[model samples]
Target: MRSRLLRTARCLGRDYTKPSAQALRCSGARWQSTSGREWSTPLAKTLAEAISVTGPLPVAAYMRQCLTSDLGGYYTSHNEGRDVFGQKGDFITSPEISQVFGELVGLWVVAEWMAQGRKSEGVYLMEVGPGRGTLMDDMLRTIRNFPALASSLEAVYLVEASPSLREAQHKLLCGDKPIEEIDIGHQSYSKYADNLKVIWTEDVRFVARDPAKTPFIIAHEFFDALPIHIFQSVPPSQPSAPSEITTPTGKHTLNETARLPRASQTNSWRELLVSPTPPYSNHASLGTPKSQQSSGPPPEFELTVAKASTPHSLYLPETSQRYKALKNSDHAVIEISPESQAYAADFAVRIGGGTAPTPTPSLAATSSSTTTTTTQARPVSSSKPEPVHKPTPSGAALILDYGPPSTIPTNSLRGIKQHRMVSPLSEPGLVDLSADVDFMSLAETAINASEGVEVHGPVEQALFLNAMGIKERAAQLVKRALDRERGASLEKSEGERRKEDLTETVKRIETGWKRLVDRGPQGMGKLYQVMAIVPHVPPKEGEKRRRPVGFGGDIVV
Candidate 1:
C-alpha cells in the first residue's frame, strides 16, 4: 500500500505543482497583514505528498517539516536573504539596540575568565545566533581594552545557520584587516591568524575550542527559536484513546506549526480542565498554584502543554522542577523544548567529555502512540551536531534571553513581525516564532553530562547587568560626550566639524543607553534573563574570598 501511494504521488502532479505553487511557495516569509491561513505552501505540498505515501502527521511533525525542511525552511532560506534583524529587519534584538549590551557581555566574559584563575592560555569565545555580527563586534572591541585578556583570546566561533547572516558577520567582524576567504562553501571557517580561526556553522560541532583554555559561550535569543511541541491532558478514554488530543481553545500554531482546520489535530490557546484523567509525572504539573491552592487537577480539567520537540516523543515526567506550584493549577499549560534540551546535552558532552553519553533514544512516531514513547535511532538534524573533536574539559556558557527562571513554560510561545504580535500561523514561514527558554532544564542536562560542570545565575538580566557595571559605564559615556563637546568647541580650525561629529555621537550614545535600560514592560532591563554554565571545582575551606563577577547579588535560582 505504501509503495502504491508513493508511486501515485510521483505521477499525480509532478508537472502540475507549478500553477498552485505560489500559494504554497514557502518563502520563509514573516507574518504580516495577510489572512490566507488555509492556503497551500510549497512545504505543505511536499508534506501532502508524504501524507499521500503515509497519512496526516501529528501537529509537531507538521511544524518540524515547515520550519526545518531543507527545501524551504524558514531559517534555511535565509528569510529570502533579507535582513531578519535590526531597524529595517523583521525584529530588533537587544544587541542592535545598543553597543552597551555587547560591551557589558564582553566584560562579563573577561571577568569569568579572571575568576577561573586568569588563564594566559588560549580562550574560546563563542556566540550562538550572532545576528549581523553586531554583538560580537562590540564584544571583541570591548575585549581589546584589556590587552592581557585580548592577547590570550585564542578563537572566536559563531554558530549561525543562515548564509546571508554569515556574509553580514564576515563583513562587519573583519574590520580593517585585509579580507581572506580561507574556506568558502556550505559549511566553512575563515582564518584570520595562522592559529586563530573564525567559524560559522548551523551546527555547533564544527567549531573547535581548546578544552585546555577557558571557554565562554554566549546564546542570546537563541533557545526560544528552537522547535517546540504542545500537549494537553483529557478525560480518560473508555475503550481506547483517540490518535490525538483535542480542546475548546481552538487550534493555532505555537509559532512553528502550520495551523489547519481539524477537530482532531491540536489546539493553540491555553484552556483549563482538558481531561479528567490524571497523567501525573515529575515534569507535568500546574504552573501557578497561588491561585489554585490545590495539588491536583480539578473536575473536567484540561491543561495545554509542550513537552518534547515532537508530539511523537516521550513526555517523561521529572521531579526536579522548581515551580511545583505551577503544575498543580488546572489552568496551566506546561511547555518544555526537547530540541533545546538536546542541544544543551550535546554541548555538555563536547565540553565535559566524560563517558560518551548513551546515544539519545530514537523515536518511532505513530498515530495511536502520539503521547507514548518507543526507542530507536533518531535523526541528528533535530539536535546540535556533535563537535569535530572532543572539547577540552573546562568551559563556561552564558545564555541570555527573555524567559522565566524555571525549566517549565507557561504559554510562552509567541510570534512577531515588525516588532508587533501576530498569529504564529498567520503567515506560516513569514514570521518570527519564539518561546521562553527553560534554563533549569539546561542546567540539569549539563549536570548529567559530567562531574566537571556546574550551573549558575539564570538570574534577572537587570541584576546581571548592574553587577557588571552597566550603569557606571553609561554614565561614563555620557560624561565623555560632554567632555568631547567642550574640547571640540575650543579647537580653532576643526571646531565646527568636530562639534557636529560629537553632537551625533552624543545623541546615539544617550538614545542607545535609554533604550537598553528602559524600565517599561517591553524594555530589556528586567524582561530578559541570564544563565551560565561553568566548570565545577569545589572551593577550598577558608580560601581567600572572591565571587564570580556579575553574580555578586542574591540569586533565586
Candidate 2:
C-alpha cells in the first residue's frame, strides 16, 4: 500500500506539476457552438441541451448517460441495434474467446463449495452482467459434470439491465421458452436443466438474498463498466501574474520586488466535468495531445475541471485513506466509483451475514440495491423468547476485471468502437465506454461491509489462469480435436478437406486459449485481473485459513 501511494505520488509529480490553464479557462461557460444539428448523436444533442440548462455534467453523469441512458445508450437498443460483445462487437470477452475460461470458473465455484463443506440444498448460482449468457452457459455445462454440485443448485439468477441483452440471454439459455414477466423483472426455466429455474432482474437487489440459499456469484468484466468520478488535486490559488510586492519598509518595493508569500491553504480536490467542445473543435483546440487524439473528428464533448468543489469530490476521495494520503499532492488525479463500491459491499453482505447498508450519497441515485438485504428483522411481542438462528457464512463472489492490483486507477477511462480505441467523448451512445476497476477499493469495501467476508487475489489474469490449469485444459482440448479428426476420416478428397478443417479448429483452440494467457503489452492476461470475496471463519488456535482455488488454494475434492 505504501508503495502504491509512492507510485501515485511519482505519477502526480511527473504528469501534473501545475494546474491546467486551458482546463481552468474552459470552466463556467458554454463552448462555442454553431448549431445544435452539428452534434453527432441524438444523445449528444440531449446532453448539450441539459448542460446548457443546468451546467457542466460531471464525468460520472456523462458516463452513465453514454453507457446506460434509456435514450439509445451504448448498451441499450440504439438506432443501429448493435451487439456490445464478441468478435463483431466493439469488444470481445474471455468467455467468447475461449470456453476454458468459464469452465475453469465453474470448477473454481465447485472447489469453493466443496471446501466450504458443500451445502446440499439452498444453493444458488448468480451472475451479474451475464453477456449473451455465454459464460453462464459454459459454467452450467461444466458444473453439470459434477453431479453433486449440479444437483444442489436451486435456480440461476441473472442481473442485467439491458432488455435487448436479456432477450438474447433468454434465447441462448432458455431457448423457445417464453419469458413471463414477474414482479422483479422476468423469469424462465433453463433449457440445459428443465427443473432448474432461471430468473432475470433489472437489478441485483430484486433477487432477494436468502440467508438460507448459499450463492456463488460471478462478476466478469462488470466493474469496469460502472461509472467513475475523476478528481484532480489542484494547488491553492497563485497570483495572476508577476506583481509588485508591498512592504512596510518600502525597501523591498518597486524594481526590487520579492516573491509573494504563497497562500496558507493546501491543495484541494476538484472534480473534472464533461462539457460540450467548441464547435469545429480539434485536438489542438481542446489541448488534447496528438497521442491521445483518436482517428475521427474532434469529440463532441471535452473534460474541464470544475470551478468549485462538487459533492463527489468532497465525499468520494475522503472515504478511503489511500486517497487521503495524496490529497495534498499537486495535480494528483484519482478516479472513484461509488457504484462499484456499493456493489462490492452488497456482494459481501449477501455472502456473509450483515445488515444491508444504504447506498452512498454518490450511489443512491444510481443503484437500486439501496436498503435491500439478506438479513431480516424478527417481530417481538414481549411474550415467549424468540429462538435465534444465525446462518453460518457461506458462498463466494468471484470478480474478474482489468485494473491495477493495489493502486487507485488514474486516467484509465477509454472508448471502444469496432474493436478500435476511440475518444470517449466522440460518440455519446455509439461508442463503448469503460474505466479501470479499483481492485483495492473493492477489497476495502467488501471487508468493511461484512465481518464474515474476506477478500483475496486481484492477481494478474495470467497468474490466476495458470494456477487454474489453463495450459492443461488447452492441451486436452487440442488432443480431443486431433482424436476426433482421426476417427472421422472419410474419402480421399473429403479427408483432405476435413484435415484442413481439423487443423484450423486445432489452431483456433490453441490460439484462443493462448490469447487468454498472453503476456504481451496489451494482452488480456497482463491487463485483466481476478479477485474473490469468500466467507471468512476465523481459524481457531493454529488452524489455517481457507484459500479458494485460482487464488492460491488447491481443489479440496
Candidate 3:
C-alpha cells in the first residue's frame, strides 16, 4: 500500500495539470502560467525541495505546509468551508461539539471588557487557531443577543497561521462586518492588521498593545497545542558493603573428610562450604582426626536467608555514597515548556505597552569651589544609577491546557489519531505530540511577568464548566428532550416505560458529567486542569473582593 501511494504521488508530480478553478478565481490573472504545467510552478518546486531535504515532515508541519506553503497551499485550491468542519474534517473540537462552550466564552469576554473600563469603541474578539470558525460562529451568535456588547466589537481578529483555516474564518466573519487582514510578512500568517485600533498576532508573543489598555484575550484549547520538551529521570544504583567471610563447621578441612550436621534438615553438610562471616561468632567447629584446622577465621560464612526486599528499593536507590556508582540507574520523565514561558512573558510585556528598555546614563564632570580660598577644582566621578523596574499593567491571562500541577507518575505525552491515543514519538509530525502542561511552572511565569496578574484554578475542566453552568445547560437540554417525548403522546404503557427510560438516561448523563468534572481516580476531572491569571485588586475596608469566576480563592501554586 505504501509503495502504491508513493507511485501515485510520483505520477501526479510528473503529470502536467492545469490550475484548479478555485485557484484561478482566488488569484485572478496571476493564475495564468504560459507553461501550462502546475508542477513546474515555483511553489511546487519549493515544496519538492523541502520534501527532498527533509523526510516526511511532522504532522504539525505538514498541516502548516498544507495551509501556508507558497506553492500548492491547500487554501488556494480548496473551499475552506467545505474542507473543514461538518463530519469531513480531521477532527472536531469542543466548540463544534456544542454551542454552549462558545457562548460562555462570549460572556466571559464581555465581562473582561467591562472590567477593563469599557472605553474603546469595541474589543478585539480574537480567536487564535480557530478551527473552521465553529467557535466564532457560536460566540458571535451568542454575542448578538447583547446588542450593546456585540456592537462594541471593534473587529473579529482570527489569528490563524493556517491559510486553509483562515479562509474558512474569513468566509464565516467577513460579511457585513469590517474585517482587516494582519499580514505577518511570511507564508505563515500570524497577525491581524487593522486600522490603528490594535493588532492580534498568532500567539500572545506578538500581541501589539499597551498594558493599560487591558485588551481582553480568549484562547480555547490553545496553549496545549504548543510543543513540550520531555525528559526522563535516571535510575538509582545498588548499595555495596563489606562483610567478614566464614566456613561451615564439621566439614572436611584440608585432609579430614567428615559428614557435617544437617542444617535444618535441608541436606547433609558433608563438604566444607565458604560463606560470609556471621554477625555473632557463636558456632564452634567440631575438630576431627587428621583435620588440619587453622586458628584464623574462615574466609567466608553464611546466615539464614530472609525474604527478598521490595522492588521499590531497587528502582529508587537512595542518593548516598554507597550507591554513587549506580546513580544513573533510576529514571522519571520531566517535561519543560521554555517556549511557552517566553511566549507568555512576551505577551505580558506587549500587553503592558511593550517591554520598557533599560536606560543607560552618561557620566558628566562636576566642580565645586572651596569656602575659604580660590582653588582649582577637579571633576568628580559618580557611580552609574540602576534602572528602575516598572510594574506591568494589571490584567488577567487564563491558560487552559491538558496537564497537572505536579509531575505525573506516568508520562502523559501522547498522540491521537482518529481519536485514539497513539505512541507520541512514533510518527514525528504525522501524529500530535503533547505532554501535560505543568500548571505550577506556568503560574510562576505569569506572576513573574506582572504583580497584579495572579494565578488561579488549574482546576479540572469538568469543575470549571460546571462552575460556569454546564450542569444547568445539560438539565435544560434534558428537560427539552423530555418535553418532546411527552409531546409525542404514545400508548399509556409505552409512554410510562419511555418516561422511565428517559429519566434513567438523564440520571446516567448527570452521573457521567459529574464523574467527568469531579476529581476521581480515573476520570477527566483529575486529568485536565484549568489555570487562570487574574489581576490582583486590593480588598475594601471590610468587604473582600469577589474571586474570579470559575475559580476558587485558593491559588494552585
lDDT of 2 at 364: 36
lDDT, residue 450, candidate 2: 81
Residue 500, model 2: Cα distance from true site in angstroms: 1.3
Q: Which residue pairs come into collision in candidate 2? A: none
lDDT of 1 by residue, 136-206 (tens): 88888788787777778777777765556777887787644443433321322333333445665444534
Model 1 regions more than 4 Å off: 1-41, 44-68, 78-81, 175-195, 208-210, 239-332, 349-393, 489-504, 543-546, 553-557
Best-first order by lDDT: 2, 1, 3
Candidates ranked by TM-score, best first?
A: 2, 1, 3
Candidate 2: tens digits of C-alpha lDDT, residues 1-557: 34533443232111122221221111123333335345566567667766765577777777776776555467754333467788778889999999999999998898999999988898999998888999998999999998888889989999886767888899998999888977666799888788888998656656666677788999999989888889999987755544455568664433322343433256889999888887676553232335556655677788899988887787888998999999999999999988888789878888886754523322533322211121112121224222212278889999999999989999888888889877788768778888999999999999987888999988889999999999999899989988988798489999999889988988888888889989798678988999999998888899788788888888897
Work out the TM-score per prediction.
0.69, 0.85, 0.54
Q: How many residue pairs clash in all the candidates, one count each?
A: 30, 0, 28
Question: Scored by Cα lDDT, where does model 1 land?
Answer: 0.56
Give the candidate number with the greatest TM-score.
2
Query: In model 2, what lDDT does residue 545 have?
Result: 82
User: What lDDT does model 2 reach?
Assistant: 0.76
Give one digit per residue, the lDDT tens place, for model 3 in 424-535.
3222222333456667666655566655555666777777777777778667767877788868868999998888988887775566556546667655566667776655
